[model samples]
Target: MNLKDLLEEEKRVVINPLQDENPPLLVVITEGSTTLARALIYRILIDETFGPNQSIHFILYDSLNFLAFLESTAIEITACAPNLLEGISYSADSSIAFKDADVVFSIGRARGYEFTKNERRESFFEEYIHVAKIHGEAIERFSKKDVKIITLGYTAARIILQFAKSIPPENITALSLLTLKITAALIAAKANRHPSEVINLITWGVNGENSLPDYRYAKFRDGKFVEEEIKNDVWLKKNLIKGVRSASGRSWYSRSSAYALADHCKLLWNDTPKGEWTCMAIYSDNSYGVPTGIFFSFPVYCQNRKYKIVQGLDVSENLKKYMKETARIINEESSIALNAHR
Candidate 1:
């Protein structure tokens, strides 16, 4: 064989090693909140949620004030898992942090902004759009072409998808799993079961307030999957939505949100349990009457490290109206965010 062909074969072998062999190094970057990034770092290193054997390199990138915390986290990780802590780094430079990154968590408000509910919606988008643009540009220029960017907030994801140049829409997703966790946990409480036992609970439409907690396909397991009685329960139809809508306003939002973000990342890299699905705010393709180009939450199944939106489910008339309203808000939010980019 030619020398070039032999070298190409070697590269392929290194990139896609055999099943028993060590996989390629996974480089993960966290962009905004140091507190959230610190929590995720602990979960990954101490809990080993991504698998005890998987090698990971982490870069915590944020404002200059967070540099000290990032360094301390690196030390703690080194002490905890010397072998698994391949390397931990801190960066204030987006380009440096994003270089060769395989996965990124964009999980905070803009560094200088502390927004309140009383603020104008348009103003909120205008502020956060800068965060999206910065991360998007860095990802496009420095990160791997197919890097997975899991943003925390719907507005951030929408802004990135709308105006971020040269970044693939499929590569970006807003994590709606927090709402999923809240919904499942609440239903599990009513059913007197553990939250993990609640399966296929879909968080539809948007991420936070006004999101639809769909229980039609949800099931619970004792020893086997069974229809969740809570689905037909009056509390399920009424109180559940109120509970989910107020979860983000809770005092524990930062830490719990971090956990949810970590869990979503774990599911993205590993196979989700069979016969179940997860929800994420992914860019729409006109599915279920959601507008063609917005990031709306939908049920999805992950296989082979890719997610396919769950299809062929029944949508009730009431659900359709909710989706239509969500589409309108998403478009309005997108336009406001995009106008800031201009």
Candidate 2:
């Protein structure tokens, strides 16, 4: 499929608010291994939904090794300079490559810190906050009207907390949720510059089971903020860790327990409705294997050209606990950020 094909009147499917606005350009910023995967998926989806000839701009940062790996793939992508973090130093021009972007997908953050395990949390918080501010500023500067911004990664709250300077678990979770809302607000503000323009913010992540003892459902929901939860019923053991092992071609037994727990929850919940949900799982045995619980985005569809959260059915006590712990981890990360700000 090509860009022209996607913009065709016949191939277009109007889902609510997302109308065929001349096959909007997609801009992606990514870090680490997932960058390649997301880039491939984005290209395939764009081609399938629009057409092959459509021009999509992908902005990647971090890990040149991974970039080389991605270059070997079938997806045709262009590389931009200075990297995401480095680009921050040149914020004035960060958006230059994204001048025509209609949709922006951002993933991961720079991970460079050598501190005690306890202090590692604090360092990560500071790093992400700095990353978000730079990225946010760039978006505000370069984005065109009617652009949709989708942010991947579950660390938004942690980053915010680092900016705010308080590490309470509750506060960190609140900040994370707030970051999502703020991201939406930022995009809307940019779109408002033009008449009749709209901005959509789609945030994605895994559904943490609620059956665990350390579950922080309230925090994950961002203080009772109703959001959609997409459930995957495939047994976790069967599907979850396969990606980890496959991605690195090695056994990551240390993370096997985490993967097992996450997978077990999948069996406990009913499957979310098809077409309403987007699901992804990984089985890798590497450093990446440990962060399985982080929430990430998947290509999704809604009544509008936008994406909505998938709502999951009621879960069991055991699964609920696991899910809660996942949420807690998310909250805990944010807490580190909060502490750093303080």
Candidate 3:
């Protein structure tokens, strides 16, 4: 479906169960790096979903850098700063904020960087696992009574897998089992309380077929949890790689390449024919049309507010290899991040 159609579907699902007394409130917690983009997107979505006068509150937690960005943008949204700490303190604060919340959007953890490689890696893992615990605790607390949460990032999965691998075989099995159980529990809680809420656990930067677990969560129905496989489109795959690599890299080259590529792709798309798909390559000689099952984005018409993926024109072998390689690098990085955190 097209962007409009997907949004319309979301609106239908969200608004159907509403009563005149309590209007739904969207609470968003975003990381510093993507806060600007997220804020822009949130503004568009909120305007579309609840109109201009509706109440929308944005909470920026553990994000001083993002606060500056938001201030510069001048988007009128309420903001909050939550105290972050190791162990149980973080979870307590999250639970208090989540109480009486209709929909909660959480963007994973944020921490300042260290200079050395060892320090950086250690810091990253420590922050990630702690954030996972906070996330799990929050879900366990609020989801029990029917509050819906859409957590961004595979923080829980990363933590569970890491903890499982580091300990003994018995601990591994126990932790792994607990991870699966918690996932099912959250899904069940959301579905049981608010049948219409879309409770998704998504991780950015993972691409290709291997990234399915990061973006797609299990669906709860009939008192059971079933895995739902969500395929990423070409645009999402490309942009996610660029975003992750740039954000993680130490040098300006990686970051600049990401921004340049995105701008170039956008320009290319504008020049291409309407309803046609095109994938651009920096290493290859030309752009190519995307194949079926190969996620891609194309200009498409949204009827009744639904967007659909459109196919692109055909290209050469070299371009295809480049695209595949780019996706491979992204998936590899994601795996590395997961393993390092574990």
Candidate 4:
């Protein structure tokens, strides 16, 4: 037998049957580095499965046209971070890679741009807009009706999950999720302070839109993850510092994006019918009296291997103002992109 047939035979013999049965296909579209994408694929294979049965088809579309940008990122990651991704199989053929993509994660500009937090806000807006342009172009390339495109980590409840992991396992009889601006409205039964006092559930010491993704918190109340009130503030600055201390040098975007991808994969592949919802970044079109044709973040759920934005949540005046501000930023950024190209 030829090598290709031999590999196929090996796959059939080794991989679990449940996993081999129509495994979900996940694609990561990034500018130069596939470090985070590969890491995500590893996590999906190892963690998403219930028992021994775990497998997934992964693809990496290194969307870099400039050799310098590609070469620089490739060198930086390899020289600084080794084996950020060790073991995961991905297809090379674009047709096969994206034949049945369930999730598409676009990190930033495809041609690649060095993103150091700019001293000026306008510069940062340019960076953000670059990401939006790349996302739009990636879809235009793969153009799948069902594939959900996300902005790195904003589309995920990552901070909440981190906060959950921070709490004592014994204390977590119920559930706990955190908002971006986490305020301690509900007191933890085990917290040293009263369960009523406000605590900084999560304090974002870092900059960027992550400081403001429209995400929700879930606390285990009645046996399931029920959505709860989301308040914002600074209570976890020290904790965040400690976290950065414990593991430094990695970019927050990659770390959070990987987790976000894992979360999406888990829901799309393993979880079933209940349709548990999570916040996601979706393009808005006055869907709920918002803006027309701008990327917006909203709560969403995955069902039958597909995702949709959840609707009819109460929108306060402050929330509308915030949404409007975000829309303005996105629109202005798009203008910047168009102007630069012109």
Models sorted by TM-score, best on top: 1, 4, 2, 3
Model 3 scores worst on lDDT over the 10 consecutive residues at 82-91
Model 1 lDDT tens row, 1-342: 554443222110012122434553555546433566667767765656567787666776765556555566656555665355566666666667778887878865622111234543655545567767777777778888778888876667766665455678878877778888888888888778889888888988765567778887787755433343654566777788888877743535776777877788777778688887899888898888887777888998887667889899999999999989877777766666667667
> What tens-digit string does per-residue lDDT give for candidate 4 at 1-342?
554442232111111123244353444444434566545545554564322433333344443233234344433433423222221233223343344454555554311111233421466545655455444443445545545444443211121112223322111110011232122222232233332233212211122422332223333333321123222233233343333333322344454446545654455445333534544344453755656544444555556544465667666686567667655654554444456533
When 1 and 4 are scored with TM-score, the better candidate is 1
Instruction: Output the worst ten-in-a-row residue range by lDDT, candidate 1.
Output: 7-16
For each candidate in turn, give its C-alpha RMSD to the true structure in angstroms.
7.9, 17.0, 19.0, 11.8
Considering TM-score, which of the candidate structures 2 and 3 is the better prediction for this target? 2
Global CA lDDT of candidate 3, please?
0.32
Higher-lDDT candidate of 1 and 3:
1
What lDDT does each candidate get?
A: 0.69, 0.32, 0.32, 0.38
Error of model 2, residue 223, in angstroms: 38
For residue 67, model 1's alpha carbon misses the true position, in angstroms, by 2.8
Which residue ranges in model 3 land beyond 4 Å of their true spot? 1-22, 30-50, 57-92, 99-105, 109-122, 125-133, 136-308, 312-316, 340-342
- TM-score of candidate 1 to 2 decimals: 0.85
> What are the runs in model 2 whose C-alpha is more than 4 Å off?
1-53, 57-92, 98-100, 110-119, 122-125, 157-276, 280-301, 338-342
lDDT for model 1, please.
0.69
Could you estimate the TM-score for every candidate?
0.85, 0.42, 0.35, 0.53
